[model samples]
Target chain A: MSLESDIPSWVQALAGGGLIGLSAALLMGLEGRILGISGFVRSVLEADPKLKGPSTAFLLGLVLVGILAQFYFVDTLTNTQPRSYMITILAGLLVGYGTAMGNGCTSGHGVCGLSRFSYRSLIATLSFMAAGMLTVTLHRVLMGGM
Target chain B: MKQQITHFIIGILFGIGLLLSGMTQPGKVIGFLDIFGNWVPDLAFVMIGAILINSIAHKFLMRRGRPLFGTGFNLPSKKDLDRPLIQGSILFGIGWGLAGFCPGPAIVSIGGLQTPAILFGIGLVIGASVFIVKKNQVK
Candidate 1:
């Protein structure tokens, strides 16, 4: 089903955006850590050996939530074109690398960092946005407008 | 203490935005990225709304000198445009375009256990691991 099949696209889109903002705020307010996925995953992986168990559990909770959503709201979820698993893996790897080198992912920098007015985040976010624009432009040129 | 509280509040608001905008749904994102097959420019509206709200909020925040929770502003110090910056940007762009899910949405999506997201999260973990190791070695 397309976005237009049931609920209005705008309403859905707005709610999604609002939820993201709200969640990030809540995490910060409670945890004091910015909800940057790169950092969160990193901390989970290499956290103190003593904290490893809890860290792993935390990570598991993150995945569990997604799984539950899928189970409960099967119809609302939409799947993208079936690309090869390899391509998806490669993309994820690159993103991981970028987030590490850049010191933050889009959430950490683009949203959280920018909201905090961090100079590093500002540059990173700008770079990320510009790069996205360039990539799409080039992709259209190469893929013939997809 | 105050900073922590602020972050939590900000996180909650951000989460709500994600849910409201349908950003948490991979379909909406993939749909936006699938501009070649069936284009939906509505994603642009979400971006505009965010930018507008953020811009105004930022201005107001700046006027305050200090954030509600923190003693002072927290901003990045790096100003130079260098190799690491450029390369990282390129990598981020490619990942985002291919996956239709950047870090923010990916985290939010985690609340809904989709296969693609799980895969993406795994990849994210491995990628971060490599980066951290390499950084440590350099240091």
Candidate 2:
């Protein structure tokens, strides 16, 4: 379907897609670990000394690129509608709790899990999508089509 | 030293992928989630492409005895369909639709150190702490 949009570019999408896959595979190949963003965040916050250094380094790289990209690759990191701080915070809390409970997020399950042929990931992905879709419906209904 | 550098580069690669794929953009993510609305299926392309590439790479990688820096591959071996998995996923989906910022893009946004994302990151830490204290098993 790949409909055209101001934001969606098929070429870039595919290229980005490949890079993500390669990045995860590269990490797995080299570090012997699944490159789950949620896991990285957790490690940064709580891992032992050995894991801490690499996790911090990864986050540092992310921020470094994020800052430079805003100046150059400006369109890459656009924020939307600026929801109320309360709603945003609540959303953040929900994401944190959910990811922790689920044992992974998009990158962990969606990318790495599915790639490895994990049936758990398939179900988790489906459940998350279904839940996400339902949340959207609830959001629209409750927030007056926000 | 080598491990640190690899992770840094991988982070950058991942950040760029997220940005280019529009996963870093809240509007685009929300658009993808709202299946009843004018859903944008662009992310579908991103996921498919990644999965195909990774699937191939996975076969080769798993064939190896050990990783370059570790004693073994740290892949999750769990196969159970438990309540936590289901409930947690639903909770995550709700949060994702609410803000369109997951752990990946949310952490990437830390570069700018903006208020909303920073707050979200803080919340993320707190959530992790609570789960660690209570559940003790994270994927």
Candidate 3:
């Protein structure tokens, strides 16, 4: 079933995706950094004072936009029904551990890694995408609806 | 000083991109991943758009052999295909499929101070922290 909305989903994705790409480019051009949110989030939580400054600033920037969007793009940022806390937290744990262990997430492996044409990234991307698809399939089967 | 400032500004831009792309919506994310179900292909366009621009930028920037602002490009160097890479990613996917929130969206959602996002964030911190501690113990 296709979703019905005022703006087409693909258009939203492509335009927003371009901005994400630009953001990565700017980071590389100006700061010589890969804009991997998982890495930054890990660094912020790691207590390394040296890394704290840049990582914190980057994360804060994301949060700042979040705050601004709450006011400006309220409809765009729609709220979803909360899952059980146990399930939500469990999902968080899996994400945290998985990204940490894998050393990258969607942005790291999917965007930057593939852009660099690393075979390693290709494998990683395929693996995670497959896993996500499988998990969703299982969820739908066992849990009924999401 | 300049480095930190740059990260902050770019981070804001990245966040905005995420919101504009409709990636901030969990339902959309789940829809995209739900190949067996509705199978929304919006996320594929997002990836295609991002990769197309970044690939062009990468070709030029890498040829420069150094970043405009910093000493060198801080790209990942590991070439080996290892177990952790595959296993960790699979695990992350399961979590992502479960909640439809990845690290970026989860963090962005926190700006709104939503309960689910906050809870996920806390769990993310704990999960990552556990890995760090376990690695430290092994070391």
Candidate 4:
């Protein structure tokens, strides 16, 4: 299928977008920290002395909520496709290490930081997008489109 | 306690939001990244919508001296840019493009029992640990 044909309807996008924004806002207003997924992962994985409790709770919430949501949105949402296990591992390494050192990810840098007009976020967003675009192109050329 | 409960509620809301928005789907993410090809711009709207709301809300939220649950709003105050930031972002971007699974969506995928998600999540955990180990060694 052509890429254009793959996008979801605008209504779903807007509603989902609004919910994402609201969720980030609620976290900020309530917890006073950026909802960057990488940061959360780092905190939990590293056993960050300061972030242990909140991070655990947040991660738990993310997964628990996801399980419940899948049942509700089964008709609209599809499960993640399996790729070559090697590809998944390598890519996961890149994403995880990058975000761990960089201090954010799509949620943190793309949404939260960009909204704050942080210069770092701007650079990060561009970098990730460009990298993502280039990687996709390379994958298309090399892996024959996974 | 109360804070943990709130976090749990937010997590559920965030997951539902991601699923409803199709952020949990790899094809959609690939479509968004495939800007040069048969581009799909719908996910852009999700990003824009979230940013717009957050941008507006942050301004107002900043006025409050203390957070609802804590003593203060612990915003990232650093203004300096560094190598780690750029390098990290590039790697993240490449991985994101390759896998279409950032930590958030990857975790969701894992929650849903996707095999790729499981592999990627393991990578994420190990990769992060490796970075920590390497960094500690350097220090």
Candidate 5:
């Protein structure tokens, strides 16, 4: 049976986006910090004395929440597709590298940036969209329309 | 006082929303990105829904003289397009295309406890560390 039979994918996607946006707003309001993943990741790794405490708590909370969700809601979500694990790893690395280089990720720039009407965010979001388009084009060419 | 609590409450609701939505699934994300293959245009509706909700919130938020928690709106101040901006965009694009997981979804996917998310989170930490160090070194 198709997983979509239970809940429509679009509803799921929207709910996900809303969660991210709302969390970011809350974090910023409470801590006076932007809920940018790149910054959060950096703080955890480098342990900057100034940002260490809050960053660690935030990161731990993030992972903890995920684990809790999986335990309680695994059946609700479909199993991840089996594919080339190597390719997926490489992709993740690239994304990590890119967000670091870009000073933010889609959440920081695309969602928060656009909401704030930051021109820089606009550029980043456009770049993201363009890249998605190009990747599709190349994939089609390589796979002969997979 | 209450504003901070509201923000935290909103964050919890947001997390719940992500759980309800299928946006955390890599397969669904890749499927939507699969334009030339079996592209699913349904994600467009997700974007639309988010935009609609955000639009309403924006209108209400804007009516207030200042944000409840902050002195004013906490928008980004940068406007110029610089090298970091260009290079970072290209990198983000390449990464998203390759992995089908952007930061937002990646963060949410951690809930799945999947291997890919674990690996991705590791890489994310490493990359961010490197960037911070390099940035510090330059100053």
Candidate 6:
């Protein structure tokens, strides 16, 4: 799990970001949709069968990429230090509930929503960022370190 | 049929983008959120690069009227800074900070069959189901 790379992290970030933006652009341009992952998850959960094709397909695509990464880009997708199952599940629960309640996550609000200059997205992004920062700060203080 | 294929392709591109950008890695995500500590600003660049392209695309695509396959753009119309939006975001941030896996990365991880990710995915589904059930009750 080396973070070392020949290319600078910033450049990698930008190129990757461009690909994400391209995904959103193509989805909007061709399908008339916003590529928010949380929203997509919800749609899958509540699929009406008649109109569930796109969401299901999109999710499968994400999964497919994951499988492909394991085979080829293994170095790029390293996992972090393992946490307890309780914490992991708790975090997952929070993410699922929070994204659903908020109606978007980083991709939806931070990327697509902000791209469109939506004030709601901006506020949501700020709130989540602040909360995330605060949580990490508190965790560090309580748990003694990262 | 065509729409589904297009979406699948787009999803693949999006997943690759996440992997390339390091957004799928919890370490990187936590590093970015660790503002006061050894804060990594790499994620910000991801957002900046993405927004630049997306905003430009939105401007042009919106002008084109209807999309290539769909009848109209399915954009969110809500403008109010509502309570659910704020509260939900705060909760989401906490969860994200806890495990450093958001919906996108978690789903991607599940595909990879990682243990932590698989556990998180279960909790995610349960949590999301709670919200859905509650919403139905309210309605």
DockQ values, each candidate? 0.34, 0.67, 0.75, 0.66, 0.44, 0.81
DockQ winner:
6
State the lDDT of candidate 2 residue by residue for A1-146, as single tens digits: 12234654766777778888988999998999888887777776677678888888887878887787767775677776466788788888888888888888999999999999998888888988898888877887787874
Off by over 4 Å in 1: A1-7, A22-35, A46-65, A113-123, A130-146, B1-16, B33-38, B53-74, B108-111
User: What CAPRI class is candidate 1?
Assistant: acceptable
Candidate number achieving the greatest TM-score relative to the actual structure: 6
Using Cα atoms with residue i matched to residue i, what is each candidate's TM-score against the true structure? 0.72, 0.92, 0.95, 0.92, 0.80, 0.96
Model 5 chain A weakest lDDT span, ten residues long: A74-83
- Put the candidates in TM-score order, highest first: 6, 3, 4, 2, 5, 1
DockQ of 3: 0.75
| TM-score of candidate 2 chain B vs. the reference | 0.89
Which stretches of model 6 miss by more than 4 angstroms? A1-4
Model 5 lDDT tens row, A1-146: 23345666666666656665566655554444566666656665677776666655555554555566677766433434433677666667767777877777766776666765678877987887678667755755785654
lDDT by residue (A43-136, candidate 3, tens digit) is 8878778777898999999999888877777655675535689988999999999999998899889888998898888998898899988988
What ranges in model 5 sit over 4 Å off? Answer: A1-7, A25-33, A46-52, A75-83, A140-145, B1-12, B62-73
> Mind sharing the TM-score for model 1?
0.72
The Cα error of candidate 2 at residue B13, in Å, is 0.9
Per-model RMSD to reference = 4.8, 3.4, 2.7, 3.3, 3.6, 1.6
Listed per model in order, the count of residue pairs whose N, CA or C atoms clash below 3 Å is 67, 0, 0, 0, 4, 0
Model 2, C-alpha of B17: deviation from truth (Å):
0.8
The lowest-lDDT stretch of 10 consecutive residues in candidate 2 chain A is A1-10
Give the residue spans of candidate 3 off by over 4 A.
A1-6
Q: Assign candidate 2 its CAPRI class.
A: medium
Q: Residue B44's C-alpha lDDT in candidate 1?
A: 57
For B49-135, candidate 1 gives per-residue lDDT tens digits of 554455455556567566444456444467666677667866876777666667655764656756676687678778878988998
Candidate 3: C-alpha RMSD to true structure equals: 2.7
lDDT-wise, the better of 1 and 5 is 5
| Whole-model lDDT values for every prediction | 0.60, 0.82, 0.86, 0.80, 0.62, 0.89
Which residue window of length 10 is worst by lDDT in model 3 chain A? A1-10
